[model samples]
Target: MSFLFLAVIFTIFTIFTYFKRVFQYWNKKQLPNLQPQIPFGNCPNFAKGKENLGVELAHLYAQIKKEGWKHSGIYIFAFPTYMPVHLDNIKNVVENDFEHFCDRMVGGNPKTEPLHAHLLNLKGTQWRDMRTKLRPSFTAGKTKMMFDIIKQCQDCLVKKVENLGSVEVVELCKNFTTDVIGSCAFGLDCKSMENEISPFKIYGRRALPTTTLSRLKLTFFSNFPRLGSFLNIRTIDKDVHDFFMNLAHEVIEYREKNGNTRHDFIQSLIEIKKSGSLTVEDIAAQTFVFFLAGFETSALLMTWTLYELAKNLEIQERLRDEICDVLEKFDGKISYQSLQEMKYFDQVMNETMRKFPPVPFVNRVCTKDYKMPNEDTIIEKGTAVVIPILGIHRDADYYPDPEKFDPGRFSEENKKKMHSCAYIPFGKGPRSCIGMRLGLLQAKVGLCGLVRNFRFTLNEKTPDVMGLNPGSLFSSPVEEIWLNVEKCL
Candidate 1:
C-alpha cells in the first residue's frame, strides 16, 4: 500500500477507537444510559432544529423513569451528562449538596464578551457577590415600587387588545413584557405595543439564538469553551451588544447629570456603581440580562396562562370572577396587594407554569466530587448535571393526570402535600431565578388586566393540541396562540 493510504487507514482506526472508549464512559461508571450515536451522542441535532433540547431531555427522563432508575447518565456529543431522576437526588444536587455543584455549565469568555459577566453566567464568588448586590432590587418592596410602571404597560396592552379584537397573544404578551422590562430595567419608555417596529423588540429578538446558525454557534461554543475563547467567539451579536451598551450609558448619563433617581432596576444598579464595585459595562450587562430574562420568561408564562384559560372557559370565568372580587375588595383598583389576594389567579398561573415551564431544564456543573445520595455512584468534578424541570413537572407519579390543566393542583392544601423540589418552575435553591418575584408580578399584572377587562376564547388559527417550538430554547408554542377577545359585560 502507498504511504498516504496507510496513514489514512491508521487515522480512521484511531478515531474509531477513541470514540468507542468515549461512548463507554457511562457504562464504565455503572450508570444506566441510553445508547448514544456517534458525533451527536444522545442529544438531538439542535443545529438543524430537529428537536428541542428540553423535549429531548424530557424524553430521556421518561425513559430512565420507566426503567425505575433513580439517576442516569447521557451524552451531549462525546461529553457525558449526569441526570438526577428522583426528587431526593435532585434536592441534593440543587440544595443539600449545592456547594459541589454551584456553577452552571454556561460557556462564554467574560473577558471577550463583557456582557457575559452578568449574574446568570457568573460562577462562584462572582455570582454570590452579584446576587447579594442585586437581591435588594428584587425584594418585595422594590417590586412593589415598580408596580405602577408595570400597570401602566398593562394599560397599553388592554387598549391595544381592545382595538385589535383578535390577536396573537404570544406576540402581544412579548410586546407588553418588553415594555415592562424596558421601563423597569432601562428606565426607558419602550412603547413596544404602540410602535410597529420598536427598537427594544427588534434587538430583543436578535439577542436570542433563534436562527439555525446562531443555535449551531451556541452549541459549538458551549461544548468547546476553551477553543471558543481561543477564537474569541461571542454568542451575542455585535450590533445587539452595542445597542444595549449604548442605551445603558445614555440612561446612566442622563440620570446622573439630572440628579434623577427612579424606582426601577437601573437606579438600583447605579447605587451599586457609586460604591465603585460596578462599572458601566457591569450595569449594562445586568440590565441586559434583566431585560432578556424578565421579558422572555414572563411573556412565555403569560402566553401559556392565557392559552390555557382560553381553552378552559369555565376555569377562565372562575379566574375572572376571582380577579373581579379581589379588585372590588381593593376599591376597584389593581394593586400589588390586590394581586396577592387573588388566590384562584395564583393557582391558575402556577398550573400554567407547571404544564409549560419557561425554561424546561436547569443546568449545573459539578465543581467538586460528590457522591449521589443513598447511591454508590460518584459524580466526578467537572461533570454536567441536568435537572429536568419539565420532566419533573409532568411526571404522573408526582402529578396524576399530568396532561390535564387543573389549577386545583396548586391549591394551598395540595401544594403542601407535594415534594418541595417536584414542581420547580423557577427552579430551587440559592441559584434559582433571582428575579422570580418580579417575573411573577409582571405576569400577574398583565394576566389580571386581560382577564378582568376581556374574555378570551381560542381562535380557529390556534392548534387544538399545542406543541413546543423546537427552534426556540424557551418552552414556547410551535405556533402563535391566536385568541378571540370580547369585552367582558
Candidate 2:
C-alpha cells in the first residue's frame, strides 16, 4: 500500500512539472516570438557562439516585419521580450512610454554596491534626480572650462605615439585614452600612455571580465536581473571598485579643503553631496562610470577612426586639411570652438560610429506591462526590450551601400534627409548617454590631432576585415588593428 501511494505521488509531480510551462505565456493575439522551449528560450544555442545577439535579433526583426507585425515577442530564458519591428513603435517605446521603460536593465544592488547606482543602474526617480544634477557638467560652457586640461592630455597622447616610432598595435590607442580619461575624469594623473602597465590600465583591464563564460553570465543577469541578486555578477571588479571609491573620496576631500574648483564632473557631484541629495557612494559610482564607461568606448571609436582613415588616404588628407585650417584660425590649439567646426572630422566619427557602435545593443525592461502601440499584443512585465542598435544602423534599407565607408552619409544635408531615429550612436531619448557631448568632443579632438600630425596605413599584420573576437561583448576588432603611422608634412 505504501509503494502504491509513492507511485501516485511521482505521477502527480511529473504532470505538474510538464503543465506549469502552460502558464508561461505570451499574448498570441498578436505577433508571438519564435516559440521557445522549457527553459533556455531563443538564445540557448547562442552560448557556443551559434549566433551573436545583434545577428539573432536582426533576424527576428526582419521575420516579424516580413510577417506584417509592427512588434513581436521573443524570449530570454523563460521570460518574454518585446522586439519592436516598426519605426513608429520604436519611437513610442524609446520616447513616448519612456517612463515605463526608463531603467536600462543592467543594474547592480546599491545596498551591496552603493557605487553601482550610477546613471546606468539608477531607476525612475533616482535616475531623474541624478540626471538633473549631472546635466550641467557636460554643458558646452562647462566643458570649455576643461579645454586646457584636454589639450594637456592630447599632447601626452601624441608624445607617447611619437616615442613609439610607428608601433603596429591599436591597443596602444586604448592605453592612451585610459590615461587621458584617468586624468580628465578623476584628476588623477594616470601615466598609462607613458607605461603600458600603468596603474590605470592594470585596474581597468581587470575591471573588464576576461572570459566568454563571464560575458554570457553578465548578459543573462541583465536579461533576468532578479536572478542577479543571487549571482556574483558585477559591472566592476572589486579592486577596481576599491581603487575608484578611495580615489573619489580623497579627490572630493582635497578639493573641499583647498577650495579648489576645477569645474569638472566631480565638482558637480560635490555640490550634490553638499546639498545632501547624493551619497559618497553615488559620487564614486558616477566617477567610476565616467572612467570605465566612457574610456573603452572612446578608445574603440578612435581606434576604428584611425584604421578607416589609414585605409582611405583621400578621406584622411581631406580631414587633415580641415583640421589644419581650423587650427590655423585658433593658433594651432584644438579648442572647443575649433572642435565644433570640424564638420568633416565629425562626419568621419559619425560614419565610424555607424560602422561600429561600441555598445552594439541597448536593453530596457518593461517597468509596467506594456501593449503593442497599435496591435492586440501585450508584452508582460519583466520583459526585455532589445534595441539592436548596430543591426539597425547597418540595415541596407536605412543605409544604401552600408558596407562602404562613406562619411557623406552624415554630411549636414544628407543626415537631415534620413530617418531621424535610424542613426543613434549615442542613443536616443532621455535615458541616452549623459556624457555624450564630452565623449564626442574628446573623440573629435583625439582623431583630429592624430590626422593633422600623422598619416596612418594598414600594417602588414592587420587583418583584411576585423574578425569578431569571441568573448568580447563590446563591438570590437577581432585581431590587433595594426596601422602604420608616418609623421605628416
Candidate 3:
C-alpha cells in the first residue's frame, strides 16, 4: 500500500514540475502572455467542445491588444505560441520576412493517409514546387473555363429554392457548392442539390471532424504532430479515403484512355501527370483538397453573405439591383466580365469575409530564428506563430464600429486608406490560398443567381446573436441559418 502511494506522489510531482517549466516559456522570453491553466493552457477546453478555437483566439487577441502589446505570447496545451497583435508585425511575419515562416502548422501523416500530401500539408521545397505546378490551374483563364460548371450548379440551386417559404440556407448553400466543386474538381455530377444523400455530400461531411471522437483525433494529431506521425495516426477515415481515391482513379483512367479532355481542375492535373511529375496518389490528394476547399469555404461564404443580406434588407435590395444591371448588360447572363463589373457586389463580399472569415486563424512555424523589428525578442526556430485573423478583422482600431456590417468600408477610397495587411480574408504573400479566384467566382456566381431570383428574410429559427460552432475547427454558425425565401417578382 505504501509503495503504491509513493509512486502516485512521485508521478504527480514530476507532472507538476514539467507543467511549471512549460508555463514559464513566455516569461523567460520577456513577452506578454495570458495566464495558463493546467493541461489546456491559455486556450479553452476545445477537446471537450467548450469553445471554438477561433473564437477563443479572437478573445485572447482582444485582451492582448487592449493591453497595448504589438505582439504577445500564448500557449496551446503548454506549447509556446507567438501571436502578432499589430499590423506591421503581422505583415512582417506573413509577407516581409516570409522565408523564415513559410510552412503552415498543419499536422497529418502522409504515409498513413496519402491524401494528406496536398499543398495544404506540404512543407519547404515540396510545397514550393507543388505550388508552382498548380499555380497555372487557378489562373484567371483556367478559372473562367470552370465558370460554366458553377453557373449550371447555380441554376440547380435556384430551382431548389424556387417556391420554398422557408429554407435552411446553410445546407442549401452547401449542396450548391458541392455540385459545383464535384463537377469542376472530380468531373462527376454529384447531384447534391437534387439528391440529399449524395455520396459526395455524405463523405464531405465525414471529412470535416464534427463529432467528439473525430475532434479529439484532430486535436491529438495537430498538437503533437511528430508523435502522431510516429504512431502512424490516420486522421482521414478509411471509407472516406477509399471513396475519393477510387473516384480519382476512375476519372484519371477514363480521361487518359479515351483522350478525353475537359476544362476543369482534373484536366490540369492530368496534364501535370503527363510530364511524369505526379503520381495517381498525388492527383487524388490534390483533387481531394481542391474539392474540400472549393466546396466548404465557398459554401460558408455564400451562407454568411445571404444571412447578412437577409438582416440588412436595404443592402440586399441594392446588391440585387447591381446584379440585375450587370446581367442586363450581358443580355441577362452572368459572365466573368459582368461579375467583375459589379463593384458593390465586390464590396459586399469583402465585408462578409471581413466580418466572418471561414478560416478564422492561420498558423506558421518559424523556420529560422526571427528577430522582431526594433525589439530584442528573438522568435526561436520551430516556434508556432499564429495570426488571429478573426481578431484583426474585428479590431475596432483598424475597423471603426467593427460589429456593424458595412460594405462601404471596402470601397476604393476606404480600402486605400486602411492598412494593406489589415484585411486578409484569403491571406497574403505567396503562401496565401491559391484558389482564391476560383473560390470568389463560385461565391459570386451563387450569390448573383440567388439574389437576382429570390428575396430572403431571416427566419426566427436562427438565433438573434450568431455564435460560432464549438465543435468545428472552421468558423461555422452554432445552428442552421433558416431564412424565409420568396421569388423576386
Winning candidate number (TM-score): 3
lDDT score of residue 309 within candidate 2: 82
lDDT of 3 by residue, 46-144 (tens): 645788888889998999988888889999887899999899999999999999999887657888888989999899999999999999899999999
Considering lDDT, which of the candidate structures 1 and 2 is the better prediction for this target? 1
Candidate 1: count of backbone clashes, pairs at least 3 residues apart or interchain: 0
RMSD values, in order shown: 1.9, 3.8, 1.4
Q: Estimate each model's TM-score.
A: 0.96, 0.90, 0.97
lDDT digits (tens) for residues 1-489 of candidate 1 = 699999999998998887789999999899989888876778756424777788888988999999999889999877899999989989998899999999986656778778778998898999999999999889999999999999999999898898667899999999999999999999989889889688888998899888877776776776677888899888998999889989999999999999999999999999889999899999999999999888999999999999998999999999988888878888999999999888888899999999999999989989999977667888999888899999899999988999999999999999999999989988899999999999999999999989999999989998879988889888988888999999998
Clashes of each: 0, 0, 0
Q: Candidate 3, which segments miss by more than 4 Å at Cα?
A: 1-9, 45-47
lDDT of each: 0.89, 0.75, 0.90
Cα lDDT tens digits for candidate 2, 1-489: 999999999998876675456425554445555666545566665445655565566666667767776676777655567777677777777898887788788756666666777888888898898889888878878777767766777787777677444665467667666766776778777877667767768877776645775576566667656767666566566677788788888998899899987756788778879989887788888888888777888888998888888788899989989989989999987788888887888899999999888777788878887766656666666667888777778778788887788999998889888876788777789988888877777777677677788888888887657744445656767678878778887
TM-score of 1: 0.96
Rank the candidate models, highest lDDT first: 3, 1, 2
Clashing residue pairs in candidate 1 are: none
